[model samples]
Target: MASAQDPATAQHPASQNSNGSSDPRKSLDGVVEKEEERKEEELISPDTSDAQPETRAVTGWKWILICAGLYCAIFLYGLDNTIAADIQSAILETYGDVGQLAWIGTGFPLGSVATILPVGKAYGIFNAKWVHLGSVLVFCVGSAVCGATPNMSALIVGRVIAGVGGAGLYLGMLNLIAINTLEKERPAYMGGTGVIWGAGTILGPVIGGAFADSSATWRWAFYINLVIFGVLLPALFYIPSFNPQPGVSPVIKLKELDWIGTALIAGVYTLFVVVLTLGGVEWAWSDGRTIALFVVCGVILLLFMAQQFFAILTTPERRIFPIHFLKSRTMIILYACTACGSTAMFTVIYYIPLLFQFSRGDNGIESAVRLLPFIIVLSFFIMASGQLLGLFGYYMVFYLVGGAFLLIGASLMFTVRAGTNIGAVYGYEVLIAIGAGLIAQIAYSVGPSKVPPQDMAAAIGYMNVAQIGGLLIALAISGAVFQNIAFHDLNRLLSPLGHSAQEIHGAIAGSQSSLFVNLPSDVRDTAIELIVKSISSIYALVIAAGALCFVTGALLKREKLYDSKPVAAA
Candidate 1:
């Protein structure tokens, strides 16, 4: 066998002198010399050490196909939301209990908020195409589980799982649009995408109510997603791979994940939701459980803020919260506007069906049909806002107009009473829907349009988190307001009719808003009046939320879109 020195000399033939023979010492010396050269090269060429992957440009029919797939996925997410709203009454009727009704709505948003940051980071590190597909698959599985669940608790758990998947799909879609579209053309593409989301939002109630009304049962509302996913999956396969940080190894990416920050945020929001859902409904607001949860939530939120602040100093690169963005007044205003606007929007979506079912004596299908004006108006405005944005290149004016409409609509809704004019009621709902649609998706573009492409994902993710968080808070607070007012009002009105306190509590807890329907005719009219009053009180909160949205929008600093690159010709 050749000696070690001989092998080194053979590998490095340059070490051989002009002579035909090689020296072992010379070979060893040359090996050291070449290693030193490699070290020098590495030091000088740091960028080549972990070269970034080239961004693959997707244009033409392939891009359109990918956008179409994303639209389907988002449509499924929107359908799930309205489906739950339409089916909650059915679920309450099936279980013959109203205590868990809030959980059904609360769980999905909680899960979504919990996963938003993590999912946003995941897209940056992995192949976005695969990540998006996996999210859709997970969502499909969760939908299946929800359909097959035998009890309310299982259904709530399934909603949470599906929500986790939705968080990923939502971020993935936005990221894809941001990456693929030109800066100047992004608003139009995003708005066009919003049209799909708007259609989903519009059709969700109609389709869900039809499914619930059918022999297929309310469970079919979820089962329908599976069929939709089958069509969407093939389209997803054609999406080009997009990995923003391909140079980063999976292990390094995992290490850099802000686990502590994520855990703190998740814990804080989870506890906050628990307190809101339980307080004044299942338990007294002063109950030990409620108090403890509120206190724990407060403490955890403080810790999360502290951790975010410390992260900026210690490990800014790995921080998920992106505290630097908060320094911009416009970003803060945008977030606040998004949150307040969402609060009003979600409150309307949840409670309007209750108004129809309880006050108007409408079934699920009938209520959805009655809601058509609202859905149609909302969908129209969503598409219209995008076109307006494309032409004007300004958003604050739309926000101001939208907020004014929301405030006017919400104030008008509170005036709805028994025997209120049907025409007037529909008109009010249309106004609110138009206002909501104008502002809802447009707020997402504000941050990304102003920030660099590198910051787009985080900025958009934060906006989503704000929206979902607002929905959760609004749902919790509005539920508490509705339950407490309805319970007390019903108890006062019914107790004089010889119903015991225990009986009043039992009736209200067992039948939900439908309790008014099951009462004797003599008491029914009075109960309906009381129920309408309680729901109207919740509308008062919506008014406040809308006004806050307006104020926040007015305060937002105006900024031109930082990126003005022309779209590539299709």
Candidate 2:
């Protein structure tokens, strides 16, 4: 009801003044608004074709030495992932227990998943350089234990311990790379990690097989980690101390860790992994023990979630998991794509060798050699994608194109039969390798780019969970699927041929089994076909993971990552 020119209905100061000249403050406000708009436009626009390289935090001889040390640690982490597979036969010969075989492969990933969040929090609260060195020391100790263990149980315990350290090493390496490089230059360095990681992953089984076949023995597979760590030890001391909480005392920083939350998360993940590992192998799906474990895991997970939100165990500022990340659309989509990509990569890495061993009758060395096409293509493309990202800033394109390739590749793999041409199989491997390489390490670069400088470490840690968690879950699921399907199909068809359950299980174990070696020609041929069918079924999981990558890719914003100035802590 007020008049248009009345004080109650006055116009905005920028609109007009009494003399019809613009107010000085309003002119300044106009300029500021326009500047902000320009920045926003730049953020959404594609990067220039000829962008110059930005200066890094550390350079020259120091960075090179640091990189050598970090890459060596990363290689060891990747090597440990699949090394146990080819060496399983040797372990069985020494220990005589086939039932515990799954633990050898699973223990490392389980340890990583259980402790990664707490390790992430520690990096946020303490000196990153010392934390990194401590992780290296822990990894070395675990390796020494594995090398010296006299029994299978002790070896598994060592693998789990090694996994704990390996998770920290992996996350810490990524964090160091993020903190040391500018946002614009991060992708290239991240790609270097990808190259090393791929080399180690592909070489794992080969190295293990070589050691197992030689007088050096399978124990040296683990002992090799310590040797690498010792060579790189001095370089680590020279690395910069990236202390986020620089003024905090060590005792106070220790108190800031969410100890109860760490225990709860560790308990939840370990129980869940145990259920997955033992579900059909050690116990029936209907077993009360499995159900109880599931229930316990769920309850602990609920408690952990509550702790993050309610701050019952620690302040929200000091909590391990960034619960608020759930609110970010970008983060959510990135997490999904990362998980899908990781699942696809690990599934292929673990199962492909088994397929070759069963279907082509290849030994460990031959199967590892056949994996070369996939690993090489994957490594090359990972490096390419990273370099391209730094130049183009169009990360969405990689995820979409990579996802499509994965789908096509996995579909091709699903059709492979026992007599399929090896050349065609290698071609299919190339397609999948390209897809995985393009997307696998992209998240580490992309994730930190999107977050503020203060949250960069947390973002890297979060993606680590997605990467390692997806691998752990996928391996567990595929192993269970392969074993159950192969066992059921083999028992139904071959039990009438006088094959015992133990013999069927050994066949499921693959060509390494003496029981499989003793089978008649006709029986072996039939067993191979059934095993091939089981392996083909596992590709269905890969296909699902690939589809997820595509769908999530479609959901990400088409904006380029912009550099954020470092924000000082209060």
Candidate 3:
């Protein structure tokens, strides 16, 4: 037998044949080694040495300050989304175009979902610090525009712009944390961000309501963002200059972006939202316009998916969809769960206040105040969920329990009629809050935990997209359901009360449930009942979404939480 260290024996694992032919085992070994090397090269971060300065570690007060700035940015983003919910009524009152009201709320998320994938890729190619600061500046500009807008169209345009900026802010904040903090410490920082997010959810309504109720105009609601942005601007400087792809030229990197894919996705999302918000409200669902929109949306989405697959096979580096991540059964289930949970949460946030304002006859401020129980419980659990994850090192239980809570809460919300007991309603809100808050931060944890270091950014982006997509789809579907039901019920209830077809059409076109206030007592009571029934129907969807979360949670593969080594900062 040849010695173990013999070159011939090492190179050719299989014994040579009678002649001098190469061993098949040796060829197989070589092929496997080459394949592994290729995979490693593909996963490597862009060359940083030539393009960026030496990374100085962010520590002590400097790290604290950087985190503070990022948290503020997050707070601003969350506040923008929630503020629209409470102040939308005030906006309609001022603008006097009820038909345009949904745009005010949809515009921000539309902008967010449209740009998120592109912004995530942009961070990899540009200086993260500059990219983040530029986003903040854009947000400020949009806020200013919103504050100064003279018409509903301008306000919607400003909101879309602000949302685009917000997409950058959100991705930049998460990327900064991941790169700057030590791996072990990241969960704590992430949890801290979640707390800020929860606080924003609470404060958004409170502040928007306060402004709406005060002598101040609803424009101030947007102006407040500028003030917060000013405070966060200086902190941006303290953030470390960490560029993973320092040597790459911006022009080359720009070319590598899947612009066509991005456009297709944006078109699909925008059209879907338009169809949802306008169908049955501005145009009949069976109308040619609505059918055309749906056809276009479907074709665009299919094109986007095809582009994603093509990019993955031909140019994996440029693909926005992380094909590898999708291959994991666990990751796919987690994304589905995240979408369901998000739909439930956003549905509650947007509609709960409307429930108060319309069903119970509360003003914007009063409706917001009534949501304190939900907000407070949600805020508490957002932090608690993080702490428990740190202590117990498990997430499956949280999802299972949280989903159950959400189901119960959504079912309870269905019972909230015009004269439902306040205590019971408050209790239901608390239950929903706890479930939503607990489930909210887990995806952020689980997604990064599962992927390789190079794929962490993509994983995070995917989770965020899932969340925003959920909100978009939920808002669209629920809005369609609510409008269709309300129109049918309103017509049936009001026609017998001496209201003319023109009057009924005007009221439906107005799209304000609060219009019931102007009706005769008999009509008002009946209208309120119809509105309650219509709105309550939406919670059934929420319940189904919650149940999906629970099923996904139960199906998720168990992984040792916090056991994996942190991926090196890009």
Candidate 4:
């Protein structure tokens, strides 16, 4: 065995003559020995350190495969949102209640929010390959269950499972590419990923509408996800595995894992979600049970903060949510804007399909098919924005433009009346779709740039949580607002049409398609007109919200794209 030598001693003739301190150059054995040490440590303490990135250059096709996998997963996940809106009429027919139908859409997002943090931490611990594979597998299984679901309860379970896994896949794709790609090259790769994501969205409604129109309906939509998921196998072969640093311990910095803090966060967030889901649907928003749950969530959040403080004092390592993130003006502003965006997206999606089927006089199949325009517009912008960001390095111009588009679209939608032109009304949808596409393009960009690269996953998680949390609040409040306005208007208009308010509401409550199918042609057309007018105000409220978010986002510190050049600490 070669003796150890100080590399410094070898260069000095005097020290060399005295005998090179140990082995003159430790470049070889030190690296080899560390690998040996890690192998031995693997049995005792398992860790998949995401540090010490490899030098292997990813080729063009590998980027394509990864993008393709990410696209399928995003499309598959997002498809549920669109298809469910269209097929709500069919599900209502089977399940027999508006409350029951809402659960299918709500369940998946609940699962996603629940699992997001744990999965983010896991990115540093497990083999990313297995994590990606396992998530996809679970999603496929969930999709299968939802497709063949016999009852409302079973469908909720399936959506929850699929959402949980999908949460993993979405984050995994971003982290995997960030860790793998060189810095300057990352934008183009992300752009490619965006393109694929856009393409997949187009398939959701077209395929879903077609399937639902045929004998397939909602069942075929879920099965199609299974087929898309199966296509991910080819990319798995190329996703890189960690080779590890030669002798570094495989054990990660577990003190970074804050178990108590995690439990507190889970308790607080889960209860909050539970209460919100129940609000306006099962319990009054200000009901005793809701109030108690909200109090419990607050207490839990307080406990979490206390635990973090204790960790800072007691632990031998660094803090988790370091002060930099907390003090960041840019981070806070972005968080707020993203929250508003989520609110706008969730609100419109809930009501627009209702309007289309009831007012536009479309079938469940036709209503879902009509959403293709929004999906098409959204996908086109995502691809274009991603590429533009990669090439020019500044995407805020698009963010502002997109924000303005959404504002205009929402304003137009709000102004609509009983006899609104179908073509003109839908022009609003395309505008918001374009805006949403542009905002999404910049969201993944903004949060990552201002924060430390080491904290990228956590930052991404924060942005998502903020966005979704807003959605939860918006859904409960807005869902109630929508129901009240639509019901009140339908009640007033139905009297003139010689229908009872109860009868009109019964049709509106179920799904858009049912509102038409359940009524006579004259009543159906009349119900359509009234439903459209009432919802116009709702769209206006949402448009105002989106415009505010855009204003705030525009005002946020316009940090340029993150360059690979090492940043020096002030």
- Name the candidate that leads on lDDT: 2
Best by TM-score: 3
Model 2 stretches astray by more than 4 angstroms: 1-67, 174-191, 240-247, 561-570
Better of 2 and 3 by TM-score: 3
Model 3 residue 352 CA deviation in Å:
1.5
What's the lDDT for all of these models? 0.72, 0.76, 0.74, 0.61
lDDT of 3 by residue, 87-108 (tens): 8777866676655667877888
Superposed by TM-score, candidate 1 places the C-alpha of residue 270 at a distance from the truth, in angstroms, of 1.4
> Model 3 Cα displacement at 202 (Å)?
2.9
Sorted by TM-score (best first), the order is 3, 2, 1, 4
**Per-residue C-alpha lDDT of model 4 across residues 1-570, encoded as one tens digit per residue:** 000101110111111123323232233335446556876997678666754643435568886786667656666665664455555556656665555445655667667766666666555445556677778888888889988898877887898788788777766666566556654565555555545544543444455556656776667777887876776767765776532122223464344455665566667656765675566555776799979998988998887777666663424123333334556666676676666656666555665666766665566556655665776777677656656766776545665676687788888878877577778767877887777766654665666656544455456677767765565556555555555666677777666767765455466554344445666878666666666666676776567667876786687545455552212211
- List per-candidate RMSD values in Å: 12.3, 11.5, 10.9, 10.3
Query: Candidate 2 — what's its lDDT?
Result: 0.76
Give the range of the ten consecutive residues with the poorest summed lDDT in model 2: 1-10
What is the Å distance of residue 557 in model 2 from its true position? 2.4
RMSD of 2: 11.5
- Expressed as tens digits, the lDDT of each residue in 1-570 for candidate 2 is 000000101112223334544332232235346557877987899478976765765689888889899889888988998887677767777776655666778788888888988887776566678888999988888889898999988998999899999987876776676566654566566656766766787788888877877899989999999888888889888777666555557998789888988898888767876787778777888999989888999999999999878889688777778777787777888888888878887777777777898888777677767778887787788768767877887788888998988999999998988888889989988888888877887777677666554465566677878888888878777777877888889899889988888767766776767767777888878888888888888888888878888888988778664442222222
